[model samples]
Target: MRSLEVCKCSKTQAWYLFLVLVVITTLSFTGRVVYLSLGEGYGISLDPSCKPRRHVVFLKTHKTASSTILNILYRYGEARNLTFALPFFDHLGYPQLFKARYVKDFERNPSKEYNIICNHMRFNLPEVRKVMPNQSVYFTILRNPDQVAESSFSYYHDVTPAFREAKSLDRFASRPSTYYSPSAADNHYARNLMWFDLGGDHNAQGDPSYVNSTLQALERAFDLVLLAEYFDESLVLLREALCWPIEDMAYFRLNARLRLSVAPLAPAASSKLRQWNSLDWSLYSRFNRSFWERVARYGAVRMERDVSQLREIRRRLGATCLRGDAPAGAAETVPAEIRPPSFGTAKILGYVLRQDLTGPTRELCTRMVLPESRYLSLLQRKQALIKLPHNMENRL
Candidate 1:
């Protein structure tokens, strides 16, 4: 009787443990199902006609309003209940590879498969193909090299450690071999311009031929080409190609910088700039002319119509309203005391930062120390003015 009682107790304990495990597994499965359902339903509306398209890649470039374009693409994916192979970081680096197991994940559960990917990635056709094997569309943008270089110089000067201690554009330009060479630092503009102009490969010795090869490769791979100078038209072409709804093609706003009035370039300065970026300028001018020629062959009127339609769409989408205009009132005017020094260290820094620096010393201030005191006073005065009530009319 004692043996039988012991056996019965052991059987009961085994059954209890099995029941608990079964319940836990059921709960886990239920949670996963709920999560997937929510994710699929996110940003989706009642559009049965909208189907998830697969295998699209966007190669985003710098200073080209790529961020705004990416946002539009992201929204479109969300609305159509599609997934995207988004970048791990806001910008990518190195071997320019995507490690995300997008295909495996899709195969496992088979929820709406991601069809779009927009990231600041290096051009790697092989890596991209690994993720998207089916019929895929690839595209990227190009900007005028001179403008791109100028914008890049300003951007690095303001933001980076390399340019912080340096005092002039001349010094920066002299060291182009440092940043532009194969082993140089990874900067956006230089790297992108080089890759887009030359083929995406980086040989030990920097070669312009690589750029031409890369362009040829891209021409073979991509179905369409977009120019940064004509972004709105490009967007329209993209929308038509994808057959996306008008609402889906609406632009997104991002990364706006204050527009400064550009000074007229001196003849000598212009010549120097041309010399500094000769390879880039040559590549840009050639490609730019070719792009336009291709468009002309397609019909200029159709392009104009597309641009007009995009502008109207932009207005309707409330994108234009986000742009900043010149500040209102006399307060916008610069006070004489706070005006920039006629010659100072900042001027020297600006001069040195230029692509060419062989001009007379008279053009640049010799001062080494920053003009911080004037800048501080200006900041304080601006803060005080801001705090003053709008109704307090002519108190100053």
Candidate 2:
């Protein structure tokens, strides 16, 4: 009788412990679900006091070290717990889509305004006002047209299949007019120089109408303009204008790779490049003069001096460390071993879903999803996953 009683007590204790474990597991899952549903959107503070109250828009151009600046802004946003009107797609091309009321609708519940909005958006004044109604600051960088053309040509030639068949740079440089004449899908000059920065179509010839439009926009919308050639100086002015932290002004090196070199261009080839880019040179010179005039009128010198003082402060704070051999605005390279794989359909879908979701639910869903093959393929190719078509999905 005593033996039987002891066995019964042991069985009851085991059942109680099992019940407790099951309850704990269920509670853990429920807590996660609740956090996902309510917590993520409120996690970041987009209040005006965190940085400055005004809207800041950066016109990101190719090969102008714009990416480096964007990275800094992104970091600043993160530190301040602010949110960017990050594009649904990989790049921001259409300004018409981001109107003031549209942005308000996009940011429906937050009740707060955006501190900064920067992306690869086309230059549109009325559209910009729709999003940033008050005293918003607008800025962009300009590079020497000749250098811009050369860099753009080389970049496309190395990366795109259309340029791969060209025998030499001379062949590519021979036809400067065709480089940006709508036929070239990789029309960097047309896109970066004409539409986005200058607010005009490249097909039109020598109309200062675009220039006038840009100037008017500056008068009405922008407080500052930056030159890519003088990037350090540009950042200094930016720092002073925004009264940003000194560390924020420091340049970051990002997105660069060492390449094997071909022989130096012959004198004939060099001259060809110059001859081909005559239109670019002319436009650059014309715009540059106007840009300087605007700067003078705005008392940019005083801004520069203020920036210099801020740099000194940053130097004292030990945040002024310079990168070795890295070009301005390049990102640090990840080691091959730890780097994520390429993008594929599933990855693209996952990215889109994450962007679509709001609050804690989005965060939870993002964490729960498995690493899809599409993502791995995209990482390997270094291209936007969504750009690939459904027909080619299997190729990834």
Model 2: per-residue Cα lDDT over 28-137, one tens digit each: 22213433233333222223455553467776766566655775565455334444555545554553333443332344433445566676666666766555536666
After superposing candidate 2, which stretches have Cα over 4 Å from the reference? Answer: 1-53, 94-112, 158-167, 177-184, 188-197, 208-220, 256-283, 290-396
Distance from true position, residue 358, model 1, in Å? 58
- Model 1, residue 285: what's the lDDT? 65
Instruction: Indicate which candidate wins on TM-score.
Output: 1
Per-residue lDDT of model 1, residues 1-396, tens digit only? 755543554454545546645543432212222222223322212245544345678877665656557656654453333546543334334344444332323333334344776666666666566566457777766676555655555555544433443444445455544434444354334433544423354332336685566557767777666777877767766665565544455553343233442223445544555565565555456567766776776568877765665555444323222222222121222333222232111121111112232222111111111122332233223323323232222221
Give the runs in model 1 whose Cα sits over 4 Å from its true position. 1-54, 94-113, 158-162, 165-171, 174-184, 187-209, 261-283, 319-396
At residue 311, candidate 1 shows an lDDT of: 57
lDDT (Cα atoms) of all candidates against the true structure = 0.47, 0.46
